[model samples]
Target: MTDTTAIDIPGYKQGTWVLDPAHSEVGFSVRHMMISKVRGAFGVKSATLVAPENPLETTVTAQVDATSLDTKDEGRDGHLRSADFFDVENHPTIDFVSTGVRIEGGDFLVDGDLTIRGVTKPVTFDFDFGGFGADPWGNYKAGATAKTVINREDFGLTWNAALETGGVLVGKDVTITLDLQGALQA
Candidate 1:
């Protein structure tokens, strides 16, 4: 078992950190026809991190433009934006609000509610602190990588087609990974 004591992060500071969208990415992968994986990314609308002296008290809120989903295929992208999938016209954004942070098995975990297609569900992300540093321009920045998986049908993303060979066109589980870089607010 891993220790549950408070973690010590070197050079950690308490302040509001605004995500640099140009340096951040939200990507996902889902099984296609139970044979291969279809990977894509979404454009972040906004994300903010409120770090406290104690890392466990940190909070995060983020939004992703659902309409910005791109899978390198225009036809498939259009279908995902339709009512058959994300229904982006009605739910133009996917939102996430952190509730708490903790350490499990020596790994950081951020618990939060994820809303998609207007349906909300609790999800936990495996968080990794990528350390704090300053850029050549002297801007203090923080980086991290987080990931989680959820069932598509749990959030009203249930549209799928049965394959002739017996599987489904889309997998139920989707893996979401986030690479975030945030600049400290002055």
Candidate 2:
């Protein structure tokens, strides 16, 4: 039998928390023309995380502005915002809401509903808790790195083209990386 009794974990903290977007980054990369990879980042608008006094009972929710997507390339950015891709005009935001969390090995799996371009899909990300510390200002802070890969088409991002030499202009698989910092709001 498994112990359902809640126990305080050494590094776990409870209460409302805010994502420090200035210290966080949302990045993604996908194969371009099957020969090169294009990478980009979106500025996080707002995020919040809550724990029920125990890390095992936690909830996370985040929202990101779709228009904040930047690749450092104007042409590509515009293309990505067009109907061929994100269609930002219609869907102005991307969001994630955690449904479950499970620890495996030394890491965690964050299972959530990821919505993009009005399409929602179940996504699971591998997460690493980077411990907790206090800042000079006396605020508690924690960090985490999470990553996952998904088919862009699954989120309604179906833009692509056949290269003259071989494969399509854009690859279907997109790898997402989230480097996050959270401020304890307890």
Candidate 3:
């Protein structure tokens, strides 16, 4: 087994960072039934990462376009945007604002409030440091990944169809993954 403590990169100066939307992705995966899994991604409209003097207390705020959701299948994507799910017409964006952040050994934890369909709930995402580097354009870039599992029904997204086999059409738990790339703002 690999030691996670060795994965951390050196911390940078305290400052604000802007997410590189072109390289960052917010995606999710969930069981389609009792067997298969379905996946989708939402476009990141804007994001800001606020690194405190002590990197461990970093803060992240992001807004995702609800209508920009895309999956491999158009029909399924349409359904996800409907009232049965996200109801894109009503909730035009999905937002997250971090409340607390901390680092334990080599791993980081980002605790935040996630709002969906007007319902707000506290959620924690495990953050993995991906180090900071310079881009080809001379921009200072930083990379990281965060993941968490949330119950769809907990946010008022309880719509579902009973499967003939005995399970529901949609899975209750959704695995959210975030691959983020940020550029420090001088």
Candidate 4:
């Protein structure tokens, strides 16, 4: 549980904040071949934060364009968008809706439901605030980074190939990260 009274955001305000998609990113990294890691990012189709007087009471929702996945390899990217993985044609977007927020020690934990390929699971992202400020045009902005890890199988992403040496083509766990920036709405 979070002691909302203990949470003090310096420049916080109560209002709706819209994501600055141009400055925001939703990325993931997964273990490849039981060795190195492969990283990729998806386009943030939309996101919004409804901040109340108490930041802990804020609610967040975001949609990620799964079809926009890019890993710098065309073939791999195409495969990821196929039914074997994200199934972008059938499940075009990965969505998230916050359920709760809490403070643990010096960090914030955002609890939410993450849906992928029609499978929904609870996840907690360790959130780090990047402070609030104003841009050159005087639009109040806020920046943050949050991350969590999940098992690909849990999301129905069970496709894999076995190597001759006994290892699998892909690892089970995946790390999801969000680099977010939003502007406070008038």
Candidate 5:
């Protein structure tokens, strides 16, 4: 990516920004056993944001290795990688490609298609701009947050167990959150 510092892109920096994985995180939480929530983070991934000449035409893409899911529990993470869940051997990556972007209520609404387990669905994330600045290392940096919720079943991640408590072991809904930090590249 080329460092773009001469122009300012709407809702982002002037040029392409490469995701700093060490400073960014992709995480999720879902109700478990109908009583509590299970939270986890995918610590491995790659993402990029391209700010076009027309700032409003910006685009973004991301890929998450399904096998990197870490719920902090060895057994559950192993299960999540099996055929009953992500089936990492078959569908190793979950991906997202933005289709459109617009400002709404002072925030950026990014509309995109998210793919998981070979299933794709339209989703929109509320994007929060964290502004652009210079890091201590003298590199220009940009930061933001994206958040959304999706139905696990919609993405073919419907595996679950029934609880005698009248609810399923895992909730259908999953909340995803992304904290993004990027460095301007040239």
Candidate 6:
């Protein structure tokens, strides 16, 4: 019998990692008036990740400022900050802490606790590993794209209005996207 180990893979090294916000983006989209979708991005302030050689044993934590929400429309953005929505004044930050990571068909399922508006819920995001490489500055960089969907109402953001057309003003489902880049920590 032959024992084989220590094969070098492109990525899968174990170490502490820090998110590079300048290269990362957290975005979301929600149904608007049942006729269109409104998209916005949250400036990911910071994040930390710890991964073993095996991607499955990874832990990730991130924080996003709720007040940094921007939808390209000031009026709508203001509404989202009020009591009817995120209530940025009360909940200044949104947080995520991964509980587990699983890989399926080359994709990853990152399960974590997501807190918004004082409500905490378990959510899972489908993530795609974008591989890893060394940067010009000698920093190892890893990239990933993640996506998930949740009901806004579940987070105590139930403010809504009835439209004359016989539907609610906004839909309940909100889709989120995360474009993340992490730099190897020394």
TM-score of each: 0.96, 0.93, 0.92, 0.97, 0.91, 0.92
Model 6 alpha-carbon miss at residue 120, Å: 0.2
- Which pairs clash in model 6? none
Q: Is candidate 2 or candidate 5 better by TM-score?
A: 2
lDDT tens per residue, model 4, 1-186 = 455664678888789999999999999999888889999999999999999888888899999999999999999999999999999999999999999888878778899999999999999999988999999998999999999999999999999999888899899999999999999998
| Model 3 weakest lDDT span, ten residues long | 1-10
lDDT of 3 by residue, 84-182 (tens): 899999998999999877666556788899998888999999988788888898889888899999999999899998999899889999999999999
lDDT of 6 by residue, 2-89 (tens): 2222334467679999999999999999888899999998888789999777666679999998898999999999999888898989
lDDT-better candidate, 4 vs 6: 4
Write one digit per residue (lDDT tens) for candidate 2, span 101-173.
7776655778899999999999999987787899999989999899999999999888788878978999999
Winner of 2 and 4 under lDDT: 4
TM-score sort, best first: 4, 1, 2, 3, 6, 5
Q: What is the C-alpha lDDT profile of model 1 across 95-144, one tens digit per residue?
A: 99999888877788999999999999999999888999999999899999
lDDT of 3: 0.87
Q: Scored by Cα lDDT, where does model 4 land? A: 0.93
RMSD in Å for all candidates: 1.3, 2.0, 3.6, 1.1, 4.9, 4.1
The pairs that clash in candidate 2 are none
What local lDDT score does residue 123 receive in model 1, on the 0 to 100 scale?
Answer: 99
Residue 47 lDDT (model 5): 88
| Model 4: how far residue 95 lies from native, Å | 0.3
